[model samples]
Target: MTNEFVLEAITREFPESVLLSSEPYGMLTVEIKKDDIKKVIHYLKDSSLEINFLTDICGIHYPEHPAQEIGVVYHLHNMMTNFRIRLKAFMTREDTEIDSLTDLYAGANWMERETFDFYGIKFKGHPDLRPILNMEDLGYHPMLKEYKLEDGTRTDKNDAMFGR
Candidate 1:
């Protein structure tokens, strides 16, 4: 149930798949190849580790790191031991595909769709993959870092009222 126990378990079981491992805020976080994410999660859910709860699935954007421009983070919880762990898999903008976890966790459907809606990450093998939050015609992932932070064309209001 300790962080070291979970870290050692995952690294020992998936030596090559684990790209990086760290304990932040006393939680075990492991970064692995995007291709091996499904396999790794399957093992963690079904193995003795008993990390059975899929707490959340979210996306991250790192525009500065072209090689890893997009990332998916999985948060898992073990009810028996009250233990938790974080798994991350990142890929480039050119290849933004990762296996769907819906088969393993039904709750993944909505979470995956939300991630896709905002981050444009395609979840392969998802039964229904489409925008769950944004409009289908939005045409772009809003969470990506390339977009402007504010609307430069807004000039209707007074500059002093808007602090411009």
Candidate 2:
């Protein structure tokens, strides 16, 4: 139930799938190879660790890192012991698709959709992959770093009033 124990179990189970690992803020965070993410998560769920809760799934865009420009982060929790862990997988911009976890965790359906809606990271095998919070015609992933943080053309509001 300890972080070290869980980390050791995962490393032992999949030696090559783990790219990097760390314990930040006392939480075990592991960066896994993109292709093996689904397999790694499957092991964590079905193994003795009993880490069964799927807390969240989200996407990240690191524009500066060409080889690993897009990433997916998964947060899992073990309600029995209140232990938690995080897993991450990254890929290049050209390939933003990753295996869907819906087959493993039913709750992943919406999370994967939301990640796709905001980050354009497709979830392969997702039963219904579409925008959950955004309009279908928006045509772009708003959360990517390439988008501007603010509308520079806006003239209705004065930055002086906001102390900007």
Candidate 3:
């Protein structure tokens, strides 16, 4: 069962999406254009793909990389085809807002909140996007490569740990 429908939906709905691959990974990912996420998720769920099983969602931080701050990752499973894939979306600390997929996958509820906890990324329409872990006032994302010191200083923790 080729998921051409999801591809069509994405192409028709989001011609601006940075297409990653075709067929196998056709509806796998959309590079997370940030804005069209809702549309893409909805299309995937409604199309033949029916990737409704939101396995998990997490965010990674790489301060040294070109895309610093946050990298949201989504793991989806297709029950019909028994296929799984990891979708990644990058967002900077300054621009931490992305479309929500809760409407398509209810499992995204806590996962989205979890991502918000560590990365400060905001998932719009997540019902209650509150901190599930860590202190509420902790605005600094601890997962990034540029973790700050306790004295409110922006120094690389890795360097300090290794005695740089």
Candidate 4:
């Protein structure tokens, strides 16, 4: 099943937030408004979508274009249909806070922690919003383009061509 009914419901609920919807392949990609991310996430999980599993969440920082500050990717899996729905949340440093999905998916505990750890995003409701992989003292967000060193060591394609 393509879950058109679920998609319809989401479309009606978040007409503006939903950036793309492909019914043919049973795929729905929604760009969630920062404040409404949890609303859409809960709907997708509780609704007929059966997207119980929160597979992953990743943060993207594009310093080159200030318009794209933080992009959070959510991978949701529908166990019943074995289909996946991708939800995205684009935020900027000025607005680095987003609703927490921990209540919807218990598994999001670690993923959200990791996202906060690296990208410096704040999960509003995360019980213990702390670093997961990085050390406690690590203050800077190394993933951001602004963290790149003047030495240009972060991006050196020459290593691949020189073979050393």
Specify the highest-lDDT model's number: 2
Candidate 3 worst ten-residue window by lDDT: 21-30
lDDT of 4: 0.79
Number of the top candidate by TM-score? 2
TM-score of each: 0.93, 0.94, 0.73, 0.82
Candidates 1 and 3: which is better by lDDT?
Answer: 1
What candidate 1 gets wrong by more than 4 Å, as runs, is 155-164
Per-residue lDDT of 39 in model 1: 95
Q: How many residue pairs clash in each candidate?
A: 0, 0, 0, 0
Clashing pairs in 3: none
Task: Summarize candidate 2's per-residue lDDT along 76-152 as a digit string, tens digits.
Answer: 99899999999999999999999999999999999999999999999999999999999999999999999777699
Question: Compared to the true structure, candidate 4 yields what TM-score?
Answer: 0.82
Q: Candidate 1 lDDT, tens digit per residue, 67-157?
A: 9999999999999999999999999999999999999999999999999999999999999999998999999989988987767797775
Q: Write the per-residue lDDT of candidate 4 for residues 90-152, one digit (tens) a residue.
A: 877788888788887788889989989988988888999989999989888778767544455
TM-score of candidate 1 to 2 decimals: 0.93
Better of 1 and 2 by TM-score: 2
- Report the C-alpha displacement of residue 50, candidate 2, in angstroms: 0.4
A best-first ranking of the candidates according to their TM-score comes to: 2, 1, 4, 3
